[model samples]
Target: MRRRLRVLVTGAAGLVGAEVTARLAAAGHEVTALVHRTPVLVGNDGTPLEAAGVRCLTADVTRPRLGLSEADHEALAGGIDRIVHCAAITDFGRPEEDYQRVNVDGTAHVLELARAGGADLVHVGTAYVCGERDGLILETELDEGQRLANAYEASKLRAETLVHKARADGVRSAVVRPSIVVGDEHTGVVRDYKNIYVVLKLTTEGKVRSIPGQYEARLDLVPVDYVADVITQVTERFDEAAGRTFHAVGAPLTLRDFSDVMAEYPSFQVPRFVPPTSFDLGRLPREERVYYERVVALYESYFRRRMAFDASNTAQLVARPAPGGGQDFLRRLIDHCLESGYLGAPLPGVADVLARLDLTGADVSGPAANDANGAGR
Candidate 1:
């Protein structure tokens, strides 16, 4: 019988990292979780992973050489056979160098650790690396003349490029690109703000009042569990995926449908979605109009277009799905948001929505502390 494998995971405290930790431990692998610091308590849904039979260690990717002492590095190298990297800062609003620091340089640091341990590397990358791709984004296509939307995409592309560079240098590496990460379909458990969740927060806060485009953009979301499952499968079945890139994405949802679904609460009004020509420039104060203009510009680029994902390679290799949910189910997810007080209050009109579906994010959205304010009620 094959002996249990020793695996090292960076960013084990993150959404993908935490789920990956649970899955790996459940699979009977000896898992070592790497993190930068010990928070008061990891939001169970937070970045630091929690699971049975896993050893948690301290390590920061952004530091020089991963911020580890020689002894700690040797201790990790002594038993680790594979390395999974999922600890990138996906904030689109950050500067270029910041993204490069975590996404590019941090990846290089992880590769260095993998080399030290003679372990195969699994690199977590973003599907947005496709960069303004319009349709049918394939798995094997990397340099397909796609332009990056922001620093986040550009830095991810650079990081993936570095992975390939390491492979050329005789390092075994696998690249996993997940698109527009959402809450777990089965659990609705996402730990932090990234991807489409930010839109919900900003919109619900009334920061994004009006959109000057058709609410017809495609927002492709993949669940954390599916991503974790696929990552584990790829690690176990590394040979089939070595030197390959995978696109783990779902079918896209239009912008109008997305907003409507997230606004199941009557208190949370659906903002007006107007065509550019229909926007009344004279109605808003000049500064407010400029703010709206910025919102319009940002959303127009990202959440406003139709995008197709061709996951044929990932499909053939991992043989799993990207957890599909239409706007109706998404409304029920909003019901969890209200009940959990993540939105600051309960939804007045969500009794019907709550009755029809299960809400999983309630546990995921509440704060990590055993305190009351963490989750709302």
Candidate 2:
């Protein structure tokens, strides 16, 4: 039997936070979900947090003492046993000031809350805090003189630095860095479809046909549930998790594999990969050039980096096996997109097309067959 403790989760309305909050409440813990503008907390699998007995408190992370009233703050400080700091601006290309205020300063405020409550802290960070680099990234490594790719990564690094400083000052803290978070492993259901999904939407819609990237660049995609699981485990087993870092990451897939998988879907348009050095956006069609410049260009770093996260600590602590990142999984993601109408209606399958052709007495042989097969590709 596990002891139920009072736990406070910031950003409870966000993806990972909601899942963590739901899990804690379901496990019989007294969970307080702190939210800002988005007060409704829904787990990754679409479970309402409140219905699971989660108490949602409206507050701003960017504000000191989490913008709570004095009485509320005192009550939280007195009763809370653990604080899971999940509030952070995760979007890329945000203004540096926004990142600093939300991610950096917000973390500082959360630390103060932890200090007041004498609560163990479980901070959610990103594996990309290792920055724009290749090869292996260890959990013990931070600030290896690698250049950061965006303001979001830089802000997370700074926030982690604060956590490390607090740990040195005797705050029981642990950092869990999750790589690119995606849908669930089995159902492929995601709460939100941002990040890589944006570029995926553009490419699959034929809005962007050519992208500048290396064929072998790797993308590490971890399931949202796994990340939440890691966070919840660390919170529950604080004694063993203190003063350590864990990577909640999944297996990685290469750009070639991604392209091949997209090509397998007859409704998906596979983007052509061109080396960054020789690629010129000016040569693209007008509409493609617009989409590339406005949307796809923002995600260029993700398409070029081949960074691998080493999750030795996570492997030791987490009992769940790492989720698969193969063709079938990719297909599952795409299938969900089609089913949810996120990608609009999918085109008819080859067999369906063949049946229609038979009814119309049209040829399904030679060049016509090849043309039908190559419709989306």
Off by over 4 Å in 1: 1-3, 39-50, 259-265, 275-300, 344-377
- lDDT (tens digit, per residue) of candidate 1 on 203-289: 575444565556776777777678888898888788888988888776677877876665656567455566666666545533334
- What local lDDT score does residue 85 receive in model 2, on the 0 to 100 scale? 93
Error of 2 at 92 (Å): 1.8
Output the number of the lDDT-best candidate: 2
Clashing pairs in 1: 12-49, 13-47, 13-48, 14-47, 215-256, 367-374
Off by over 4 Å in 2: 344-377
CA RMSD of all predictions: 10.0, 7.3
For 23-95, candidate 2 gives per-residue lDDT tens digits of: 8988899998899987788778676656555888898989988898888887888888999999998877677
Task: Score each candidate by Cα lDDT.
Answer: 0.71, 0.84
